[model samples]
Target chain A: MPYFAQLYNFACWLIGDRVAAEDLVQETMLKALRGFSSYQQGTNFRAWIYRILRNTFLTSQTGLKATASLDSEDDALPEPATLETPESILLVRHEQSAIRSALESLPIDFREVILLSDVEEMSYQEISQALGVPMGTVMSRLSRARKAMRGLLTAASEGVKR
Target chain B: MTCDTWRERLDAYIDDSFPPEELNQLEEHLRVCPSCAAEALHRLKLKHATKAAAAARFAPSSEFRSRIAQGMPSRRKRLFGDLWIPGLAVAAAILIALAGSSVWEWHAQRQQALAELVDLHVTTLASVNPVDVISTDRHTVKPWFQGKLPFSFNLPELENSPFRLLGGKLVYFNHAPGAQLLCASGKHQISVFILQGDWKFALSGTFPASAREKGFNIESTRSADLRILLVSDANPGDIHELAELLKAAQQP
Candidate 1:
């Protein structure tokens, strides 16, 4: 039962629509239940279910759009490690909004890395298995994603300053 | 090693997944290079803030939950010639109800109330304007709910706490009016619901102190004749801090 909430949250973030995310999670659950026997013992079950959810997303319309943008160089954010993360940034309302909008505007690939690493707190290996990507790719994507997030936050705070 | 190489490793280090040898090198570099150290700090802060901002999320309603539960593939039904086992189970349930109906009803009612509370938490957060009485002062908000709800709950002193009193509003549960006190903890808004604790379906005192539903954490406790239920997406530690503060304030 708890699995449903986490899956639904993951699906919602991927699809960007509440209604669609519900349907996606329901489908994922059904598929998981029917294929329970196929799941081997002692494997990373969370990673396996996430893989199913992500795979399901990859076939959906929103996912196709994200796929198209995956290689689009124009969507890449500048590397921004210079910005300070002074815990108080989120304490302020505008800064909080800035962080959220920055996330929501990110390319789906970047967004997923941020979510998996930071929000879901999945390991590199687990994330690798879930996304069907190699460990190195997970590392690179997560690195770039954080850099991009930092970049956006910096820009948003500067905009507020003006 | 160059800072660029160290930068790449810092990301891995922040996740605490790097090897000991690599960590020794990274730690050595961090001591020498202020810029690299600052960059690492930036990533840590970003991860924390991102997690906080992404806290409030949606969950399926109770209807959808039961639909999934009932719809799960029953291995027994598959093996026992279809309806045969289900029919017998229902007969057994009827016999049990006749024997101790309150026990059966207790479980169902508790689940339903918790689900409804979570629903209210989500719905209130989603709505454009959440509370009727909007004030950050505990003195102001506590009195506002005095007449609106059947029971009163003490609003904790949040001066040194992570939470701040948001306000209160009247909410109905199972057609009974209750007080919903909203509190802000960082980026997350925690709802403290005080309802008549003496209702027929009183919690068994063994209610799990905390449970997560639809992305939010729901914690329940009883103070006098009032049931204090809190719902939020704040970090668990922060939730516990606020819960302790509330528990202290509810003291007679």
Candidate 2:
């Protein structure tokens, strides 16, 4: 489902570990299901679900003590391994992975806003609600996140050229 | 404005959050400043990359769905044998009388407690102290709770799910130490509170089991000696499913 994948991708990016991200997402869904009756209909379900995912990620005990790191060096990012990919599709996948790695390498605050805005396609207001921050904060964070992502991607590209 | 100022404003300009005058100024500055122009182009590329990465969505595997389903409490099982029918009828009859007697004192206390929890929930939504500790490892989250509360709580990592471990914070609910677990689903936030108490004291036939106040939903359930409360604006069905999954994870 779009809902599940969106959450999963956000989780993977947030935690930066696929295995841990998967577990956190599962718990998030479980909690979401239990509290389904309280969800307001016709409202922003994505925002609501995102809030749950954020909270679940924060409280999980798995690696809470590990200092937050921005290193994407260890991330075994999903590569396009399917056979018979058109050259264009392959190019697009490569670009996507590069961008993903760059995004993942940014600070948590930066990564969060970028994912919400550019990736998740959340409006500034929706991001403010999900992040429990002011709209200004969302805008500022997104701006910074984008800048950081650009710097990382540029650096990664240069490194590849060497 | 100088190039630096224009560069700073580039983000707002790109997002179209700037006023018309400011936007016009930024455009003029970019036209004259090649450095700023190049930076803007790079920023656009980054934005495109982010969009492309986000657009590549992945679905939850069938196994994950089955696992979540298995984790939830079976409503059908709860409905079998008309188990709660007699209890519900009896509860209905005594509801009025129970409101008046000291025999319902504990229920009143529990209601007050829930109200306090609702207050805490609202404050958390408005505050920045969502988690006291942040980590992605289960070992990190589990031990962090030690000595932070009057009792021990287990936090199993469900990395296979959408909820990634953002962090944990220590909070007080009803003057008792409570642990707040933070997890995320996409951009959504969910707060899980595990309280140490005897559920029997709180469920004494009078207190409402679940209620939605303000815009948030609060649900409490008991497993053995632990009482868990999930607070969010997410669908109640999702919360219930999460509770069941949590219960399953806690099992041996």
Candidate 3:
């Protein structure tokens, strides 16, 4: 049951729609069951399940939307904010909703890295395998993803201050 | 580490990906470099806030949990799951084991038989005496086997076909005397081995049983009183075509 909830939460974040997330999680469960024999024991079970779910999403209609949106790589690595630290802003006071909206507005790729790194706390190795990318790609993507996320959150907070 | 390098690695540092020695170096840099220190602090705050917000936002609803529970598959159905017949399960188990071994043995024998037939094909191609009657004429090849075998078989006319009649030989399969007609398609040689028997019992097949082993395509069929097996390394499609031709021309 805990496993299902975790998967559901991840799925909900990935697709950003409740009904679609439920259906995606259910399909992931079905595929995991059917191909369970191929899954070797004494391995990262969580990573294995996440990899399956990730693959299912990639090939799905929603995943296609995510892939299509990834084509606009112009803003993939936004410039880092170099202004003096806004210490007077007390960012954490307004961070909860600002950060959530920031994550919600970000592209699927950036959101994926943040969710894996910050939310799930998956290791770099596990993230590489789960996302089916090279280790170096995971590092660079995660770096860019975090930078992009901060940009979003900063922008949201600035807009709210106005 | 320089500020630029530390900037590139700030996320990894916070994610604790750096080795302890490198981490110590970065922390030493952070102590002196207030800019790098401030950047790390902001990154840490951002990571913390995002984790908390994502956790609070994406919790699966109770209804979703119930849906998943309902979708969970039950244990796979077993043959003896419900019914408990007196001594039935034991008898079934014994019968299954015997049947399994026999089926495996039968499959092994069939594979061995195909291998032997393939060997015969290779050896015949190399042998000096490939056929008892070496003739391309169907009329001559068809009659040369009379009185030598218990049954007669039809030979397809290959006058204009890609397959040319090379010759025919007398062969044995399972101690049963049969006719082996050797034919050719371009560079490939084809051997058709025919055994005489009650067609239905000998074949137990209405259609040709085809297999490929040891680089040879083999097709077996029953036509009239002959159990015909064709072996070749030629194209599989061509083998089936020749098999169909032989099946069509056999005397009813």
Error of 1 at A71 (Å): 3.8
For B119-189, candidate 1 gives per-residue lDDT tens digits of 56765664334687899898888887666565667777788877788787776654457888889887889
Candidate lDDT (C-alpha), each: 0.69, 0.61, 0.69
| TM-score, one value per model | 0.54, 0.50, 0.55
In model 2, what is the error at residue A160, expressed in angstroms? 2.7
Q: Which ten residues in a row have the lowest lDDT in candidate 3 chain A?
A: A83-92
**DockQ, 0 to 1 scale, candidate 1:** 0.13
How is the predicted docking of candidate 1 categorized under the CAPRI scheme?
Answer: incorrect
What is candidate 2's lDDT per residue for B111-196, written digit by digit as tens?
44554465455545444344657887868987888886888767666777766767877775543567887766567667788887
Winner on DockQ between 1 and 2 is 2
Residue range A1-162, candidate 2, lDDT tens digits: 338777877887777666666676765664454344345587678886787677556444432332233333233333223212222222354677777676656666677788887777677878876765557667766765665555565555555656
DockQ of each: 0.13, 0.15, 0.15
Error of 1 at B242 (Å): 65
In model 3, how large is the Cα lDDT of residue B122? 57
Runs off by more than 4 Å, candidate 3: A72-78, A83-90, B72-252
